[model samples]
Target: MTAHLITGAGSGIGAAVSARLAERGDELWLLARDAGRARELENRFPVARTIVGDLAAPDKLSWALSHQELPDRLDSLLHIAGVVELGEVGELTPKAWNLQLAANLVAPAELTRLMLPGLRAARGQVIFVNSGAGLHAGAQWAAYAASKHGLKALADALRLEEHDNGVRVTSVYPGRTATPMQVKVHQQEGKEYDASRWIDPESVATTILAALDLPRDAEITDVSVRPGR
Candidate 1:
C-alpha cells in the first residue's frame, strides 16, 4: 500500500487532501498542532494515524517524527502547513515574523530534509502547498509572501537535488481558497471577504492528487490553480 505523510492535516486543504487519500485506500500519517482536531480526524478515518505537534517548533516536529513510529518508507510527503500574518513591512514584530517563517518555510523544509531518506528509498514525491502570493507580490503581505517565496525556492532546489535519486518535487500554487485561514484573515481585517466565490478545498486536493499520479518518467514541477468566473 502507498503511504503518504501530510502536515497541517487538521483543517483546510490538508484535511481535504487527507480525506481523498484515505478514500483511495492510501495509508496516511496526519500531522497537526491540535490534538483534539487530529483525534477528530482519526475518528473519521479509522485507518489513519495522527501526530500532534506544532510544526512551528523545530524540536517538537523532530520529536514527533522520531517517536511516532512511521513506516520505513513513504510514497509521498505533502508539505501543507502554512501561516498568513497580514502586516506591512514595518508593522511585523520580530516574534511574529519568525513564527511565520518557521511555520511556512523552515518547518516544511526541515521536515522534507528529515524524510529524504524514506522518500528517496521509495522514489517518492514531495508536494508543496504553495500560494499565488509566492509567485506574485501584493501589498500588506510581507511575511506571508516572503515565506511562500522561500518555500517555492526550496521546492525548486529539492527537485534538482533529488532528480538523480528518482524523487520528484511539485509545488501547487493555489489562488484564494475558501479555507478557515482565509476566513480568519478576513475577520482580522474586519472586512467582508468573499471566499465562497474563490476556489474550493476539494478542487485543490484533486489537483494535488493528479500531480501525484503523474508517471515516474515525468515531473510536474509547478502547477497554478485558480478560480474561474
Candidate 2:
C-alpha cells in the first residue's frame, strides 16, 4: 500500500482525503499540533499513525519529526493544513502575517525539505491544497493571499527541482470550500456562511485522488476547483 504523510488531517479537506486514502488501505502519517491532537487523530484514524509537530512553529518541525519514526519510503506528502485571517494591509499586524506565513508556507517548505529523502526513494508526489487567494488577492486578504501566493511559488519551484528525481508536484486551488475555514473566513468578513453555496470537501478530495492516481505519463501540475452552483 502507498504511504503518505498529511498535514491538516484534523478536519476539512485533509480529513476527507485521509479518510478516502484509508478506505483504500493506504498507510497514513497524520501531523498534529500536539500530543493531545495526535491522540485525537489516532482515535479518528485507528489504522493510521500520528506525528506531533506544530505547523505554527515551522522552525521546530525538523526537531519534532527527527525523534519520530517515519516511513522508509513515502508515496505522497500532502500539505493541506492552513490558517488564515482576513485583514487589510493597513490593519494586519506583523504577528498575523507571521502566523499565516509560518503555517501555510514555511511549514510546507520545511516539512518537504525534511521528507525529500523518503519522497525521492519512492518517486513520490507532493500536493499543496492552496486557495483562490493564491491566484488573486482581494480586499482584506493581503496576508492570507501573500502566504498562499508563496505556497504556489514553492510548489512550482519544487516541481522543477524534483522533476529529474521522478517526483511530481500538484497544487489544488479550491474556491470557497464549505469547510470550517470558510466559516471562519465568512465571520471575519462579517458575512453569514451558507454551506450549500460552496464546493464540497469530498469533491475536492476526489479531485486530489485523481491527481494521485493519474497515469505516470502525465502530471496534473495545477487544478482549480470551483463551486458548480
Candidate 3:
C-alpha cells in the first residue's frame, strides 16, 4: 500500500482529502495542529496515524518529522496547510505578513525538503494545494498573494530538480471553495462572498486524487479547478 502524508488534516479540504485517501485503504499520516481533532479522525478512520505539529514553527515541524516512524517510505506528500490574511498594504502588520509566509510558503518547502529522501526512494509525488489568487493579483490581498506565488515558484523549482529522481510535483490552484477559510475571509472583509457559488471541497479532493492516480509516464504539472457557473 502507498503511504500518504497530509498536513492540515483537521478540517476543510485537508480533512476531505484525508477521508478520501483512507476510503481507498491507503496508509495515512494525518498531521494537524489540534491533537483532539486528530484523535477524533483516527477513531473514525481506524486506519490512519496522527501527528500534532504546527507547520508555522520550524522547530516543531522538524521534531515531528524526526519522531514519525512510518512502516514504509512515503509515496505521496500532500501539503494543505496555508493561511490567508486580508488587508491593504498599509494595514498589514509585520507579524501577520510573517505568519502568512511561514505557514503558506516556508513550512511547505521545509516539509518537502525534509521528506525528499523518502519520496525519492518511493518515486513519489508531491501535491501542493495553491490558490487562484496566486495566479492573479487582487486588491488588499498582497500578503496572501505573495505567499502563494512564492509557493508556486518553490513547487516548480522542486519539480525540475527532482525530475531526474522520478518524483513528480503537482501544484493545484483552486478557486474560491466552500471552506472555513473562505467564510473567515468573507467575515473579515464584510462582503457578501457567496461561497456556495464556488467549487466545493470534495470536488477539489477528487481532482487531487485523479492526479495521484495518473500513470508514472504522465505528469500533470499544474491544474486549476474553478466553479462551473
lDDT of each: 0.88, 0.96, 0.88
Q: Candidate 2, residues 1-229: lDDT per residue as tens digits?
A: 7999999999999999999999999999999999999999999999999999999999999998999999999999999999999888999999999999999999999999999999999999999999999999999999999999999999999999999999999999999998999999999999989999999999999999999999889999999999999
TM-score, cand. 2: 0.99
- Candidate 1 lDDT score at position 193: 89
The number of the candidate with the highest TM-score is 2
Q: Candidate 1 regions off by >4 Å? A: none
Candidate topping lDDT: 2
TM-score of each: 0.95, 0.99, 0.95
Question: Which 10 residues in a row give candidate 1 its minimum summed lDDT?
Answer: 58-67
Candidate 1 lDDT at 161 equals 94
Candidate 1 colliding pairs: none
In candidate 1, clashing pairs total 0
Residue-level lDDT for 142 in candidate 1: 82
